[model samples]
Target: MTPTIRGFEHHRVPVDGDVSLHVAVGGSGSPIVLLHGFPQTHLMWRHVAADLAAGHTVICPDLRGYGASDKPAEAGPGTYSKRTMAADVVALARALGHERFALAGHDRGALVALRAALDHPAAVGHLACLDVLPTLDMWDVMHGVDAAVGFHLYLMAQPPGLPERMIAASADAFFGHFLDRWAADPAAIPADVRSAYLRACAAAVPSIVADYRASAGIDVEHDRADRTAGNRLRMPVTVVQQDWGAALGFDAASIWRAWAPDLRHTLTGHGHFMAEEAPAMIAEELRALLTR
Candidate 1:
């Protein structure tokens, strides 16, 4: 009972050194790549990818350290930097014959998409980010109440071996915590999919932590350099997010506006896994962004 995207053809693509991604391709028009968030695979795009596939060539990939993709041995800075991961996404699209493609990401995947747009503006026709802020803004917005909500980010950002050991001890509980707590309706994630996510995470404790650790260190430095140079997303950008500003007492839109000069920001009461919790809306917003 392996998870499969109906009607989509799957392929393994080599992007970086010994790191290959599992990508699902469907449809036959312009290309649109979808990146999934943490503790989930490209399966997160099951609904949206199918919808977008009706009129576009939708590409969904299990990002480097997650899903059926290669985890790779932890190698410090460059191992799972979003910049490197973002380049993987761009290279993946190009290898598939798309010179430029519409891009969308959820959670961690959103961070990668943001980086891709900044690092290779000419390659991204349009961008959509579901339920996440830029990495730098994400760290800066954390304070009292919100910090409590982001405890895992701090925990996973710890030195290697330590975080991996702790997470491995209670893998299911640790991975399942966010899947249950962050969703408006936990049932939105089918039981089998939930089990699949937990299993993938439990098996790759070190690489998963390395992915987060890069964000705490190198990812931030990369972001700082971009900000210093006044780099902004020149492509049309659309963001869909749960109202973290309302709950956490920070201005979410203003923070995102600083990075996306051409922006469409939508505040939703939908859950953090918005693609699953609200597919039609997510699909509509993404289509709207490309039409611009």
Candidate 2:
């Protein structure tokens, strides 16, 4: 039977000046902040969060510029940087009365989680990243055949005004293409959920493009500076991903090891949206990570 995620209470809390997040909170125990990836919202964690809430308090938030969160126009380089997004997570957790909490992020949220660990090592007690590599390695690994796997990366990585304009022109087709192509089982996401995602992305075009553009520019500089400073994720880290790196001629674990000393890496058969495609397995992996 498909699970139900109806009881959780939704909230809109201020993070930084003029920016707030629509968050869902449920269960009660040690805190675990669940960060959703791009083209998705906190609803991505519905199944997983419901399970984890049995033994933990789960806080799932819509990242800025996505879902019901504030979609303010980009205010400068600092506004959409992962560093700033990470700080928003910190503030959200603190606002919820969690001084330190375990954090897990999928896709784009994984990037934010990495930044959170580096920027606020004392706050994120345990870290889990699903289906992504460090930004620098990600850029270095994309070429030739593997390049096709992340067409959106290049598309959204384009300089400012142009990409945003093009994407806005064909919003549904651009976003729907990823929805159809990436899912191992399209039926897994019901039409309502899919429509919700499309509408959210469509409405947040400028901010969404700016977020990706920042990754191609300032986010890369942030990652390179961290590497130069020898900054690493201080918490125990668990990574679950499909073997994209091996298929693309890069050692995924080795790349992650450079950033996280205590790491557990697993290759799953699920597609890019592992949390939704294989929630039970993802939940088990998360449970084990928390225990360790």
Per-candidate RMSD, Å: 0.9, 2.0
Runs with alpha carbons beyond 4 Å of true place in candidate 2: 1-4
Local distance difference test, candidate 1: 0.91
- Compared with the true structure, model 2 gives a TM-score of 0.97
lDDT of 1 at 107: 93
Best by TM-score: 1
Encode model 1's per-residue lDDT on 32-146: one tens digit a residue: 9999998898999999899988999999999988888999987778889999999999989988999899999999999999999999999998999988989998898888865
lDDT of each: 0.91, 0.89
Candidate 2 per-residue lDDT over residues 187-250, each given as its tens digit: 7778878888888889988988878888888999999999999998888999999898667888
